[model samples]
Target: MIKASADALVLGAGPGALAIAAALSSENLKVEVLANSDPHEPWPYTYGIWGEEVDDLGLAHLLEHRWKNTVSFFGEGADNPSSKSNIPTPHNRDYGLFDKNKLQHHWLSQCELAKVQWHKGLAQKLDINETESRVTTEEGKTITARLVVDATGYDPVFLKSSESGPVAVQTCYGIVAKFNKPPIAENQFILMDYRCDHLSEKEKSEPPTFLYAMDMGEGSFFLEETSLGLAPPVSIETLRTRLELRLANKDIRITKLEHEELGLFLPMNLPIPDLKQPVLGFGGAAGMVHPASGYMVGGMLRRAPGLAKAIAKKIRDSEASPAQIAQCGWAELWPEDLIRKQALYKFGLEKLMRFSEPQLREFFKGFFDLPSSQWYGFLTNTLTIKELVSAMWKMFVKAPWSVRIGLMGMQGREIKLLWEFMKPKIKN
Candidate 1:
């Protein structure tokens, strides 16, 4: 059996894990990554991020498409075959579609240069002591490190699941394909087009979905039918059918397919890993994916460096024990302020998931009507709890009577959650 040790050990090689590896390695710590897949494999998912986030990550060069304005279409008019007025609001925030092909190679090359070790294997078990953490691989390899990070994406074997029942999920299917003409607008992209004409009567029984279309340049555009939050998740078959129907409505013809992006199992409202266990969590395992939007790559990238630095500091602090170090690092990743922000976001997700098709249209109509800061902050997961609550209140005030009534129709669990979120902040 092979045995290895390092200053830190990262499980999983997704964007979150890789980012953590790079960050730690740059800190001059010995870091090794373990995952089942090859490090060179291209990420199948195409990521969209606010342009500024990409710039901060030194990944602006990885953007293949950029849009100055983003628009959201909602309301019954959006679902109309003839009504072109969906009451679109153009936002000032810049959006970019990443070149996933190049991004994987770029990050991988950076890791290599930083001397991050790569171990290709599935992590079967994790063991921790007061001084160090150990990992057992499926191939009978043992790895020990001062700090063990579970950047292992969703469905982690190392991290314990906190939720008893199913967690909320965001599911999507997308295609980068050729068309005779641009299927969507030339320069602008639709972040969420909640036109209902694409769904059949049977499909309408399920939760509402939206079209997330991007202008990829050339004759190709990337299009996705996305379900923002669902318990079991909307199936791929349903999403594909919805996408085809939406394309048909636009009279867009597909010539060739270049790539396919399918996303599933984006867990929301999962428990964060215990910091005192000589383990740390990063990426999805740490609940970094915004509960409302299921967008995480950018946030993960932006925070990874800070997390790495925190770990390095903990290791160098002679007085800090391993448990104390883990606790400090966990706090760095998810501080009290951020936890509050996440709760507000999750509350937004819970509220969003309760809407029916027509109700969804009505709710979103009110949402896009929000001021740029509120709407943008909510979508990008950058809003403070106060900002998110202000946005929610504004949306509630602006919503039609039906949507207002729907907002009040929270179930028992949701009501309990709302109470939990409020009780802590109440002053005597």
Candidate 2:
């Protein structure tokens, strides 16, 4: 039996799905969201974003904490983790941590105000045709819509990419705890602390990891040990052990464990969805996660309005084909130029995976040394193909000789990937 119908049905209850639902409803389209979990519940993980991004999204008020300056330490004096001899590089941008409960409430409220309907069920089967798409839930409920959006995140059930291969991932183990002493400066966010003084020399020879920490007010701190990107991801147990050792080396002891984030394992490189599919994909399923940075939330939020508008415009066109509607949404998310830019980013990730610890440090030394706009644009995926190419050239020039050589050695593979992405797509 057909349980419900709407202009659009979004699958998943995560931030991305709810965000798109709220936006679609605001566009005056009947929107319904289906998820196995309660949509109103607070998200389990912490989300961090650049302050400017939150402000641009008009959701700055939801930030639990903000830091005016961010810093990174490159492990200059690894023999002494706490030594002042290692100078930190300052990134001028402000960083903000989201208050999950507040953020969830805000989006839920928006959806409610727009009268977006919600269904609590897991989609068991999806069927699409010319006029409408139908989804069958686990409990024998059926729903149909003009358009279907899969924002079910990285491991989406309905949306599948055409490309298949092993993917590299970013992993971290984190904790929010009250420390007897402050683990980091209250005014600063530590973006990356590569000091390995806590590890034995043999351990240091393994894949490199870094510290990501922020001071929460009143003696509480959130700290994480992270691998920027890796294939066969660095294990949570490994990161946990390193984090404890790193803290012990700095003479920091936890007084109370306020919260523990067992692990965050996100796919850093995944193929973008095949636009020919009848159903659209948003968020992680759409490959919105930055191939190099593993950031998806801010991108999803920033794009929600435009995607909604595109879908709404097509939905209003009674003559528009179902495939046309899906294409509009998919194209809005992954335009050709953006596709090329992602290819470049994936190439960079490949190189990073091959770097030794020393080479990795030297690479970032040159990367951060680039003009703020260039580096910032690269990290945020705001750079155009030309600008990204220019940034790479500048970094190549600025990089130490050894780092330059490593990059040069990878030119063949880089060129091949770029060529593949740049070639014109042949329509079926």
Candidate 3:
């Protein structure tokens, strides 16, 4: 069966797709969302974002929890106050966790009120033509639209994988549980606690790792052991074991289990969509995730509305052919300035993957030692080229000899990948 046509067909019903769909429908464009699962299903993973991001999206009302400052510690006895190097965020650095249920409900209500259509089925194939693009579903239904957008998470079927492969992966396993007493302070969030408290000597020597803990209120916590970056990715079992050891060392007994989560991201730079095709990619498939932090929700929230407006404007005013209108959307998403930002972030990820355990300690030591604006900008994906270069130079100046040696030891393959990512920026 062929259904009604739309001005836009967005595949995937996650926050990214819904945000765009809602924005487009508000502009009086006919938009339909196709998703493989229940549209109301709650997102399992947690997210942390800068307060400014929440303000930009007008979503401060949806915050479940907030902290004025985030803290990080590094090196031996990091858990002990006396023997560790610490970095307490500057006074202005605030972070918050979203209330997933309320947030999704808000977006869904907006979409419903705007008259956005929803379909439950897997998108199977895409057929692009001069006038419109067609999508076929597993249920044998066809959807034709002036434009097709993909927000289908990490490995989108619509996107071709990069030949250069993932520069690095951020992996973790964690649990949400009730404790007799809170494991962390009520008002603080632990960004990265690198103390080696519970591990045996052998386990301690395995790799450089840290714990991410946040007080979720009401005598509960979201706690996990995370490996920031690895080429092959740290195993889930390893992360689990480390988390268990860390919790046991703290004598934090779980009274009841609320949920479990696996955080996994293979950070890579995606190729820009060809303007000749009537397709656009958003979210992870479009390289919207921050390579350094593996955060995308805030970035997508910021990008979706602007992109929707661009597409809507093209449809109303371009008077150009459908293919040309699609080109306008592609260009809006990957303009030259955005491309340069992507290259710089990808290069930073490549540099991060070169550190050994000892060098990594030295690395973060220097990282937290930098000016607040520089470190925070790097973390938030808000750094300009000038700020990035300034941060790098400051970091090199403060980095230990071991860290410097690691930087100088960049191998052939990594160098090739770095060059490839930088090639476009160089030309421009």
Candidate 4:
């Protein structure tokens, strides 16, 4: 291993890297942030995070007040040959998107004041030396640290599982469109009704499409597919046709066209990817993004601070306990039910299509709300011993068989993680 060293070596300069740096700095720990690309290159993320995290991080003022209510158009939006009746399925969530560069600048400003080392270089590969990790850059410069965080996006910096070695899925496609006018409203989301009636007859399940529409101020609305999952990728011609049809139905059109085909990929899961031994897998590398939704910024913001605290505790105690392994939130919780919920979310869209408009609204109202109370019960799979027995006695009457199965799968996955925690520890 080459000589230069630091406390932690961060291998990417993405948004998640900013948050990770911020969290560690809070505990008075020094961080080395490696920009795997040119520091001047722009970050393409339409960064979104939960509402509470903004306020908690004290960056509320930096956030645009564009989000209060969001409506997602689900169902086969393209199925109805005559889609005049195809109104989007309105779903609610506490999410917001921001300018990635601005946010990065603010975080870097803070890191500068806090004295976190910002390294400018790309990480070529990483080798774990005895009780340490060394990252070599393209310039042949090397730095070692107690741990390495592979935040290198899809480049698989160090912690990534190989495509031939347990890499589960990479679900996304590219899209780019500029608005003629501000077509999307503030706090009102107009996204791909993947199940909308506008999809081509031949557009089967191959390249999934995650629709994106963000209205930056001025008469501009950014509309394009951000990510797609398990669906056929549509051609530019096909997307153009669909976009034209959508605007026609809404009686809207835009003359100005800017850069197009931005790419967003849904987080992948299942069949535990074989990561290297012992070193920490940070950010999306650990599956922090929800498989059902590509919205991972909030999840990481919520989750990373907890990890920072755990790492701090370990340093203080001068020990890494079995409890530390159990504390690996993403690793323990991601594999189970990641596939089930994602499939069911798509199924839910199909189910919504089966309903009348009013029924569709009612179903969504119940679905998002039910999770608050259920989040606790759902924390463990198969429910508490009490709930399971009650569920059996009551004949599982609360929801559809599909939902019950999904919940069970999620819960079981959680319990298995707990079981693994009970297994003998792999000494670090």
Candidate 5:
């Protein structure tokens, strides 16, 4: 027996799921969200985004703090032993940390205003037909809707998976703590601190890791030690030890532990969903994370409105079939241009996996050396194909000889990947 029905049903209660539910409800669709846990609770992890992205989304007011000085430290300069290699290379862009409580409340308020219904259940099975889909919860309650969207996060429950090669995982362990003194400079955000000054020779020989940090004012700060991408993810324990070492090296001591973020693993370069399936996908389920940078929130926020508009159009169409609606949603999320850009990013990730620690540092040195537009465009997924190619060439020309040789070594695989990317897609 169907316990409930709506115009659209969303599985999962993450920000992505709530965002879409709110948007769809605003479009006059009867939207329902199902999740096992309380959806209104504050998110566990801290989310940071480029300030411009939040401002563009009109969400700047949700930021708890903003830092105008964004810096990255690569290592010590070869020419000047005293100089940390480009220590404090300014990104020239502001960064903001989202106020999770406020952000969640904002989305929840939007959903409430639009009359979106909320249900608490763990979806166990999915049934799809030509007109509507049904999801069965663990307690045997069934809910049906014209379209069902799986926003169930990284390990999707309903979205059909595709064959993918080895995936690299981005792992980090972080903490929010009150320090004996200010750890970082006031209003400073360290985007990537790759310097090994704090690590022992043995630790440095292991897979490279970087420090991601931000100042939260009044001797409180958030610090994370991160492995950008690795096949066998670095363990949380390892990262925790490294974080302690990094702090000790700077003579910084923790006065009180406020929050601990453990085992944050993000899988990158996963295959996009098979768009032929009747059930649509959104958020992590749709492979929306940037392949190289592990960023999704800002992009998801930026893309949500358009996706909502597209889904709403199709849902309102009398003749649109369930499969067609799903296809429309998938295509909107993974358009051809973005698809090609993701392929390029995947290729870059492959190369990064093979880089030695020193080579990795050199690569980023050359990478950041590019015109701010190029590097920024690459990270933000705003560059056209031509611009992306041009950016690669510029980085190659600027890279040190050792780094260039490492890049050259991957030419064979690069050619194969490019060939595969350029191949014509067979439409169903």
Candidate 6:
């Protein structure tokens, strides 16, 4: 017989959903986590969990691989990174890498200890009604709950595939690949260097790629940042070809093999995809991505506790949607001509450097407390003016188009004083 009902129904078993279950179960709420797969082993995302979040969630011991410091590499004109401040560590940019499988296993153990319910199957469809909720799976089983959360996240292609699901918030593609030898940096990360931007026309013809990497001590996860004009490989053969020149070259050798790939037209489906049945949206499906950089896990780990709390409170107080993971993702293509994307890029380059650890904590905390913070700080008006000027300056120099795109939309709206406010104003 199909399960009759649940206090809360969580669809998808990724980190966000897991965290939600962990939190809700803690409050003694009857939680059912529907997971389609195990979250271990290498996947499309190299979860670089933030430094403090592990200890905060009491999962610090689960971090099987982590390096303390890092340096960023820029192209020719840009100086080699001097500060390891951005390095993932216990402090500063200190983030820990989840040997994805290890962390998942650890979290799973924790969930088991908590006695949270788990059902395994793919979520097929949901029918929400005025009073109760129902979810039908592909395997001919159904589950219902008072409150339902759609944790399947943003799926641009999937939405196009079925004319269902919400639209995405941006446009991008991503992949995670392992290196043959141990990584180059022992205690650092390599952001996109001139290697990608300075590619020859023939190389460019192949496809533009941006890379982010970490040394797993023995192996590395080379993550490709999604940029404009390219999509992720539709097939493994195409992926091998795209990365063949840069990664699968003569110098690099491969010993172990693992791969995860994803492509997204971020702007394709989002801004609140429809809820089939009184279902709530969570995680990126809730617009949880950091605007300047696309680091989803960091903010996600932080939001889990709160979302769980919200769900509990709603059940207690008889609220309809207790947790509000609002839609705040605001990204369009960095306009080639609009005085927007370029300005945000430059502004973004500066802001990422300016953001302090404590400031970052406060910034994200506010967003969790209230959804508007997601749009307020960076997604404002002053960005527009800066882009207008940035577009004007491009006439003289040929800069990386990526940088230009970042500057204009870094702050979703118009930024009149990005540069003006950088330094303390000169007193009369």
lDDT of 6 by residue, 90-116 (tens): 222455777677766655666677776
| Alpha-carbon TM-score of each model against the true structure | 0.91, 0.95, 0.90, 0.67, 0.94, 0.60
Query: Over the stretch 145-247, how does candidate 4's per-residue lDDT look in tens digits?
Result: 6656666654456554433322234333333344544456653655444443444445433343435565554555666643333333234554555556556
Q: Give the TM-score of candidate 4.
A: 0.67
How accurate locally, in lDDT, is each candidate? Answer: 0.77, 0.85, 0.74, 0.51, 0.82, 0.47
| Alpha-carbon runs more than 4 Å astray in model 5 | 1-4, 77-82, 411-416, 424-428
Q: How many collisions per candidate?
A: 0, 0, 0, 28, 1, 41
Candidate 2 minimal-lDDT segment of 10 residues = 419-428
Off by over 4 Å in 4: 1-4, 50-58, 74-95, 160-187, 191-195, 199-211, 231-241, 248-251, 270-276, 316-428
Order candidates by lDDT, high to low: 2, 5, 1, 3, 4, 6
Our tally of clashes for model 2 stands at 0
lDDT of 3 by residue, 5-60 (tens): 88888888777777777777877888889999877998877777878779877899
Tens digits of lDDT, candidate 1, 1-428: 22236878889888888878888888988888888988778776778898776876788898878898688777544455456655665767789988877777666777898788888888987777666678889899988877788888876657664335557878888898998767777877888887766567887777888889887777778888888777878888888888988888768779999888765556776655554455778888877888877788888777888988988988876555556667777889877667667666666677777778888887877777788777777877777778878888989988999889878887736765666476533110
Alpha-carbon error at 39 in model 2, in Å? 0.2
Best candidate, lDDT-wise?
A: 2
Candidate 2, which segments miss by more than 4 Å at Cα? 1-4, 78-85, 411-416, 424-428
- Candidate 1's displacement at residue 214, Å, is 1.4
2 or 4, greater by TM-score? 2
Order the numbered candidates by TM-score, best leading. Answer: 2, 5, 1, 3, 4, 6
Structure candidate 2, residue pairs in collision = none
How does candidate 5 score on lDDT? 0.82
RMSD to native for every prediction? 3.4, 2.3, 3.1, 7.1, 2.5, 11.4
